[model samples]
Target: MTATPHLNTEHPKHNLTGFIIFLCSESVIFLAFFSGFALLKTAALNWLPPGVEGLEWRTPLLNTVVLISSSGTIWLAERCMSKGNLMGFRAFWLLTMALGAYFLYGQAVEWSGLQFGFTSGVFGGTFYLLTGFHGLHVATGVFLMGLMLVKSFIPQNYAGGEQGVQATSLFWHFVDVIWIILFVLLYVWQRS
Candidate 1:
């Protein structure tokens, strides 16, 4: 008689739960910033303040488009992964990463040309606080996606374990949704 070893296949619910809790906490921080901005804007004589009139909507609009499109790519990647189409998954994931990088680059360019600092005034302070934090989240999402991409290349790493990809897709979509709200608040609402 031979003794056989058994594989442990316990499914832990901690990963998804932990991620949801993290998102909830992050949303609280963002809500605080939003409330502060609303209060400050309501009290200010002018929204953008002096020397900041050159803030054009075109660049931010373009970045928004890029970011939104990345959300779609991520969806496709997740679909491919679910279907076990590794090639399609990798291609869409890479495209998603490139779009995220492009969006971040556009943000850097726009920030460089701005005449305001984080402490410039209420307008600048709130603007930088919100957008900077959001940019950091986007960078984090991109970094996580890159890690997943690399893991996918290894046969033993991501084999039959695509939960990371789904988690990453959720995070990317969250970042995109946040940016859309911020864009409307910072650009469109500010103009009205």
Candidate 2:
């Protein structure tokens, strides 16, 4: 007779702790980017990105609101999931997805206003490098959230959707926080 291996069926297979820790490491990466952004901005020579002209205020302000609101909606989604409220989770995730789309759309509008494209100069280089990286983060957040939204509709006995929900929330919130730091450093501080 051959010996058989046993499965640990007593616990959930999803690893929330590991996912949260991964998010924390990503937070540190954004922190370093913020520090570099602060230094480069303050040390600028003759002109800023648009040549002595600085970044716009109104658009970024609107984008900030969009991203922050999405974070809030995602938080609400997580709460709903914890309570086993599938309807609430689906509604919240849908709203969050819409807001995420809006934020990216807002960024595209702002990019259109940028006088210099990627080839402009130092300002173009640094501005695009940092903000573009952040935009990628936002895109990932949307994709992950969308995945969770789809998972919500599946039959019972699903185990990992909650983990995805929390991870996406952490990532979306991180994106919002990073933009706050970037906007302050790149636009506001450069002027005054």
Candidate 3:
């Protein structure tokens, strides 16, 4: 059997040391945003939007389940990739993408139903800022997952699927984790 070319090539799968550093920097940025949010949250005591009372948690909560389930599917996809089961990897990856789409759709519906727009007040602004950035990250995860699916089909990109899957999973998990904090801060902890 001819030896396959190095899958990671110049990327992190071949050398994750640098990838960890990149992840750390990303952590720093998000931490700063979270800190700013904490500071602003106190100022919301008087100005907090009452429209939040009308917010429906069911749909958003369901979306949270979608993300958590997608994380599971990603683990299976990684398993399939390790077994060199390309079709299995592709299928699970598609399921994960679909779940991600469902989560975004839920977000759109939730936002549409909100009485306050993004600029309505400090609450609206920060709410959008936190969730909007999270949505962007989810969008990026979808694209990255799609990239892995495409690469899975191309024999040339075969070796890198594992790396792609792991990186995508990392981003996905981070998105979920951030949302957990966001949910607590917005829905539970910060309640007046």
Clashing residue pairs, backbone N/CA/C < 3 A, model 2:
none
Best by TM-score: 1
Tell me the TM-score of each prediction against the true structure.
0.89, 0.85, 0.86
| Residue-level lDDT for 72 in candidate 3 | 90
Runs with alpha carbons beyond 4 Å of true place in candidate 2:
1-14, 49-52, 157-161
Error of 1 at 147 (Å): 0.6
Q: Which is the winner by TM-score between candidate 2 and candidate 3?
A: 3
Tens digits of lDDT, candidate 1, 80-147: 98888889999999999999999999999999988889988788888889999999999999999999
Q: What is the lDDT of candidate 2?
A: 0.78
Residue pairs with clashing backbones, model 3 = none
Q: Between candidates 1 and 2, which one is better according to TM-score?
A: 1
Q: Write the per-residue lDDT of candidate 3 for residues 46-131, one digit (tens) a residue.
A: 55676456456777778888888998998898888889888898889899999999999999988887888788777788778888
Residue-level lDDT for 118 in candidate 3: 82
Model 1 CA lDDT for position 115: 88
Backbone clash pairs in model 3 (N, Cα, C under 3 Å; residues 3+ apart or in different chains), count = 0
lDDT-better candidate, 1 vs 3: 1
